[model samples]
Target: MVPTLNAIRHSRRHLARWMRPQRRPVAWTFRPARAWIRYQPLGCIGIIAPWNYPLYLALAPLVDALAAGNRALIKPSEYTPRLAELLARVIGRAFAAEEVAVVTGGPDVAAAFASLPFDHLLFTGSTAIGRRVMAAAAANLTPVTLELGGKSPVIVGPDYGVRSAARSIAFGKFFNAGQTCVAPDYVLAPTHMVRPLAVALLREAQRAYPTVADNPDYTAMITERHHARLVAAIEAARAAGAEVLAHEDAGAAGLRKIGPTIVLAPPAGSLLMQEEIFGPVLPILPYDTIEAAIATVNAGDRPLALYCLTHDAALREAVLARTLSGGVTLNGTLLHVTQDGLPFGGVGPSGIGAYHGRAGFERFSHARGIFQPGRFNGLELVRPPYGFVARRIARLLIGR
Candidate 1:
């Protein structure tokens, strides 16, 4: 909610600048003619938000749509119905129904919402669901912006301190119990530092939440099924010969909480390695050299975010050059997305387009090109009624 409010404030602060027309260059042949791009609203935008950070994901895009001068219809995830209802009530009181509205329901309703002939659609969720939303939107030939999730990786360069990297990783991974889409999904560290990094991560996690089961600061999985899935993945990694380190147990059943865990060198085929571990489970993989680490990251689908813990300029530049992700936070984690100036979205499978502040405004607005020609146009010399002058001008323009 705080982040969403911040986004709203950002939009308000920059709305005027974003709405102004941008000047474009005119060709030499079109002297005295001016060109510019007019930013116009897309009319209506459809937002399909996810369960995690429901309020922020749903309203942040709406902030952009509104700043772009477009009406919006939001469909909040079924998992967060109460908040959805609250949002509907608040928006209803604040704006006319035609201006802004919220719809709440299950997958069926979400599907129907996606099929609407909106001017543009933005969906934030898992890649599987993003695919379905895009297909539904295709029926209307509506443009879409997909903010999907993937296995975001962290690379701890040899030049950086393992302990420092571990602290940042632990904070990001356990912030929402690792429910965040941009959380560090796994770590690639020097082979010798793998165990040290894992130990440091556990120490940091313990310091943050001494008691995971009953601590108010520590969050639980959103659903029982999600908790079970995480547990199964941890067990699968352990069964596959990976060394597992876990914080104290949750102490009872049905708490829907799994203690923070670290899996060391999980096999390539293990569940922890195969899927995005959107939980408080950190996997540390060993890489002998930076080249090998880059190779490993490139082997997977392009991640949504990438973290490189290094102060060495060359090493950072090499990693930046070799890898592709939606965004990056150097020597830290999850801070890149908070920057209102930076565009946030993934490339390839991670996401389709970017949005935040001005980027968001531009995403929801159309760049209509406009031109004004002077009364004395130079192109008149090459008119259709060919004469000596016209032929000469045409030959000169066309290079003889």
Candidate 2:
């Protein structure tokens, strides 16, 4: 609810400015020419939203398409049936069928929607699904913006003490029951601070949810299958010699809730370390040096976001330079994506293309470069073939 409202306020505040033409200075050779890049609508856009943050993700892109003067067709996830139906109802009332419409469906319908030849397509989901969507879009030569999830990592700087960092990591990791794409999947802790950080993480979880077993504040995993996957992963990690610390009771079978679980030195081959634990489980890896931590992260697929908790300028700069992620949050977590001015998206396997603020408008709108030739131009001088003036101008312009 909070993020949805914030996105609306942000889009309204800046949409007009982003629509204005950006007049550019012509090159020295093209003096007296009028040049500008105009933001033009791409007609119709298709938005395939994910189940997590179902309402916000579906609406956020739709708002951008409308703001850019483009009609939109939204395909809301079938997982959230009730919300999807409500969205379809509300959108149908607010917009003409051609201008904005919602389609609720499962995988087959999604695949059909993805193959549509819209002016542009935006997909938010897993990397595998994003690939299929892109492939379908490619047949029509349609442009696409993919927002996918991956295992984001948090590296704790040596100078920063364990307690504050642990609390922030726990909050970000456990928020939305860790189903969030940007949630920290694991932590790279300093060698001497690994145990202390684990302890602090458990302490913070306990402090936040005193009775997590029955606490209303603690969120349940998105579904029964997701719950089973997390539990099985945890059990696998335990079998692989990883120590697990539960801040509160692990609820009985059939309950979706899983207490905040802290893992210490889980084997790299274990399921918990191998996959994106989109549950309230965080694995901490001890590193003797900052280089080791950075290397460990860079070796894997580029993450959606990277976090470091530290006040040291040198340490911050070092991490910022050596590591690669779509976004970075220093001394905090998950707050970077909330900034309205910055572009929000992932890089490499995490995602392709960006949105939010002016970026969202530009992503949906094509920047048509307009060039009106000047009265006394060199273009005419260089147009004729084999003439002295044309030859001279060609030589001068082409530097041959």
Candidate of highest lDDT = 1
Expressed as tens digits, the lDDT of each residue in 323-365 for candidate 2 is: 8888888888999887767888899998999887778888999
In model 1, the runs with Cα more than 4 Å from the true position are: 250-253
Q: Looking at candidate 2, what is the lDDT of residue 333?
A: 90
Best by TM-score: 1
Worst 10 residues of 1 by lDDT: 248-257
Collision pairs in model 1:
none
The Cα local distance difference test for each model comes to 0.93, 0.87
Error of 2 at 83 (Å): 0.7
Segments in model 2 whose C-alpha atoms lie over 4 Å from true places:
250-252, 398-400
C-alpha lDDT (0 to 100) for residue 193 of candidate 1: 92
